[model samples]
Target: MTTTLPEAPPAEPGLKAGLKNRHLSMIAIGGVIGAGLFVGSGSGIATAGPGILISYALVGVLVVLVMRMLGEMAAANPTSGSFSAYADRALGRWAGFTIGWLYWFFWVVVLAVEATAGAKILAGWIPAVPQWGWALIVMVVLTASNLVSVSSYGEFEFWFAGIKVVAIAAFIVIGGLAIFGLLPGSDHPASGFSNLTAHGGFLPNGPGAILTGVLMVVFSFMGSEIVTLAAGESADPQGAVTKATNSVIWRIAVFYLGSILIVVSLLRWDDPAILKDGSYVAALSSIGIPHAAQIMNAIVLTSVLSCLNSGLYTASRMAFSLGRRSDAPAAFGRTTDRGVPRSAILASVVFGFVAVAFNYLWPDTVFQFLLNSSGAIALFVWLVICFSQLKMRRIIEREAPEKLVVRMWLYPYLTWATVALITFVLAYMLTDTADGGGRDQVVLSTLVAVGVVVVAVVRQRLGRGAAHDAVTSSKA
Candidate 1:
């Protein structure tokens, strides 16, 4: 009796249940370890000193709560549409239409970013091939993986995420050993707990720097919620979601906070080596790890490829969901005999290809606009998830409480608190006007969100009018 629309996938040509439990497990663990962690965390360290750990912690908690709300809804009624479909039922057509496109917009832009990042690394190793050519090659390869079947995508992710998991775990263990002076070759003067506060105190730049660090690190957590979208294709979506939600804490704690804690402990946050070499590399090198930069670069490239693969898969599924709901072209709704939404995949990647071109041809002007415009979307998606759950919880409890295997702790109170926290983060981003591009991101993303909302509203009204006319004609 829930208000959610029934997704009769078997009754129609629909997505296959292709993701295995192993694939979902790896994704849950490794999704938190993005290329950004390797490629971007140094900037946060420079901005907030050792206090960047606090920034990661705050954002980690935020992601856990958002995933909890998302898990509850998805467990009750699994669908590839994920939050967008829930928004439709709990809020309205307009909410689903708007957020779906926005989320899709986010990942496609991500595809370009990840593709370029991976290509740069590839070109470094194989200097004969230009970066642009490498980008094209990776994009095509990953797109093909997605187009083959969901299982192919899952298999590719399983290994990609696996490599990331191993790299981060190894880094943490090696770095932690060096911090306590247990690492045999690590006689670096900086290795000790004192580095946390002894150098310049933990809050070296003052406590306000934590907020700046949040802006720097917040987007790095963008891919955390991807597991929920992926759960829909698993053998048991509700179970997959439940397990992923329960484990999010340790995943973020170990991979993000634990590794970063080691980095700060192993070396001072203000180390010139950190700013010159990346955080992970700097930490490893301080501990006498040879070829640290090269090792980190390989790990980062793997992370980038993993992100690109998942970005395509996530975006296409969202587009397919939108098409199924009539918020997009029906062609996006069509699937192959293999249950792949081929059109949806192509559409998403085509845009990604164009965005990649923009990065090369017009990076300064057009590509920057695209990047900033999609910047705040992760917050927007989390906000919508929070709102959707507030309504969804009531509907599920009143109708099918039995399906409420996963519940948000403290119900509406925590939900609202999460809402306020997300709003505060957004407000923080809006006000922080400096080199971080916070203000530009908020404004440009808002402009894009407003445009999407207008289209959703007009589309909803027009559909309603058409339905009314059809009913009148039948009556006559």
Candidate 2:
């Protein structure tokens, strides 16, 4: 006689599938393009010169591999918690708790970062408003949009992302034409493919600078995984994940590598204005575009707002997921009548507001430290995704082969290679000279990661102890 098994508890209701296909498409595109690509890339160009293309290529490939691994897992079990949920299944509660909280922390800080970045531009346009006030206004508007409903958030993101996509594509096409002396008003007779090596050779700063460029630009790629998280809320998660995964290659090749190739070719990589004004603006100016700086500033502002909007959405969803798992306050798990995670969004916005305050009060001290402490978390998150995929693939194969809608290219081999490459980048980051920002980022980020690890370990142990005690009490 077989013993009857106890029925499992019903799963808690989660975020509504309000995100549409167009929303996912734009999110996938916009997620990969951030303000860093517009503004921060100038530093990388200065550091690596023309070799920055190689740097972007390396990091892009790394992201693609990581995303492939992530897609394999997410397609199998799409959820808003994303890799955090996979870590729970593949590693343990400790891994899940640590990575989830760490990721949430990263984005909350990013909300502050993006808000400040956008505020600077807004304040530039209208000096009547203080920078902090602009930051406050931007944060309040986006938070209200998110709180209203997930669809509202998606609608905002869709249009914001669409503008970015069109802007970048247009830039690439016009710049490419200018490089070949085809654009009508582009006055640069010297512009051509030779600009790549004509200056001081392609690797002007030497080959080592490529790795330095990697360290500088890798963080720009941080938001690409936002697609996987957003997919869980889409109408068809598996399909969305698969489409996003397949599109990663072309998106990186075209949007990043293609655009950068045009920029470097049209203007000398060593142009002083590239660093002073920005790479995109300098490149546009080289093509004789009127008001290039103003145009790029507008694009950068759009990107900053886009990043801020997505950051709030991602952080709140992670919090909501944690709540459902009992890893956070239960209030975070509750949804509004319209399926909005009101408490979760507000909780995320609270930290964001505090961060904004810290920015105003301690812009150079505590806020700077907070920025550094979370700097390397993108790499850490990607590393966790790699490891989770390693174990998750096997579990998926054994337990639910039919659910494997997306598959990693080389299985464990390429997966292991991706892990090795990421480790190398991290190790390189640690070895960066003290004068540069790399070493500081690694050290501060490590400290923050360690603190989170300690919390996760303690929480896991206490949870296990409680479970054991409950079992004992039931036996009694």
Candidate 3:
């Protein structure tokens, strides 16, 4: 009798490979440029002085390394689970289960946070609507966008990213001219890099401030890796990963670090405007731009909405992937005929709604706790990606080198260096104050990291037990 191989399993629902190259490319562009850089960087600059540029550059380099690792693995084996699936294949089941849940948790928390922030701005524009009502409206709109199709999410992001790109480019051009004393009515007289050193000097706070600044800057880069996750669903996964990984770095540096350079160069490090307003627009207003705050508010509102939309989509898809992998309840794996994971989307959105309620009811207690706990997971995810890529590269080289389209530079060396640098950042976090305040975000973050490690270990054992049982039963 002839032996025949079994057929492959059917693809999971709401998990179709429909995203195109353009979607992946734009998603990569949009994911890196979050509202945080626009709204949150002012405080960082205020705290660290002109040296904050170093902070951004340090974090920017780290992001490039991490994204490269992710691209290397994602190009090899594209999947919606992206890093989680790579962790499973390259490391172990526990790695996959832990990281997947952690990522899903991270995004779900982000969904609520972004929605609330976006709603606050929307309410300002349309005061007739209550803040909570605006939150509900934002959630409903993005959820509808996601439920329609992945392409819809892509289209939304393309425009959202386009607006941001155009805005940032204009800001850079105008701001650069002002910094160089070229613009009309420019009073600052070129400043000539003196602001960076004139105050307390570049390292006024010392080299240690850079570490403290990392706590803020690192989080700004959190969403950049989302592109690799979304690319798993693209028509040409390898191609998408290649383009995104190659181009995203310069975009991030120019848009983020470059814009910050302009801001700092135009104003003193200790300007009252930086502290009172806490945004680029505020900084611009301090520099004498009319309608600055309103312009910034509008830009930030768009950024918030963009983040909320992406957050919902990321969380649901992660949940859907987890369910398909048997790490989550099977129900979440089910997709609608339209290839949308309706149940998973609903489940994530419900949690987001609860978070919004929590924010409203106990703003101080609940929101603070949520922010602290989820603070360190982004690093955890990056560390896992590094390790996963480390293992995956060797395998790909041995088994299917031809499939390795996008390879990490200085393989194994730079890869390991990235790992060491991440370890150093975590260690540094333990000593550094959160936001330059006495409060210790490091301790809270460390606890979360330890908890995730414990969970990963336990899950690995459980997966092994199941595998062993299956083997024994087959033998019997």
TM-score per candidate, in order?
0.97, 0.96, 0.92
Candidate 2, residues 188-296: lDDT per residue as tens digits? 7755789789888999989999999999889999889998888878789899999999999999998999989988888788889989999999999877999998899
lDDT of 3 by residue, 1-476 (tens): 96332221124445667677767777888789999988789778877888888999988999999998898887777777888888877777777878888888788888888888988888898999999999999999989999888888888888887788888988888888777778787565676567778889987878877776777677878888788778767778778888888997798788999899888877788888787876587557755788888888888888888898888888888888888887888988888877788888899999888888888998778767766777778888899999989888877887789988888999989989999998888777766564522234556655766787687788778878999999999999
- How does residue 199 of candidate 3 score in lDDT? 87
The list of candidate 1 runs beyond 4 A from truth reads: 1-13
45 Cα displacement, candidate 1 (Å): 0.8
**How much is 284 displaced in model 3, in angstroms?**
1.9
Candidate with maximal lDDT: 1
* Candidate 1: residue pairs that collide: none
Indicate the worst ten consecutive residues by lDDT in candidate 3. Answer: 3-12
lDDT of each: 0.90, 0.89, 0.81
Residue 171 C-alpha lDDT in model 3 = 88
Q: Write the per-residue lDDT of candidate 1 for residues 89-127, one digit (tens) a residue.
A: 888888999999999999999999999998998999999
Q: How does model 3 score by TM-score?
A: 0.92
Instruction: Please identify which of the two predictions, 1 or 2, would achieve the higher lDDT against the true structure.
Output: 1
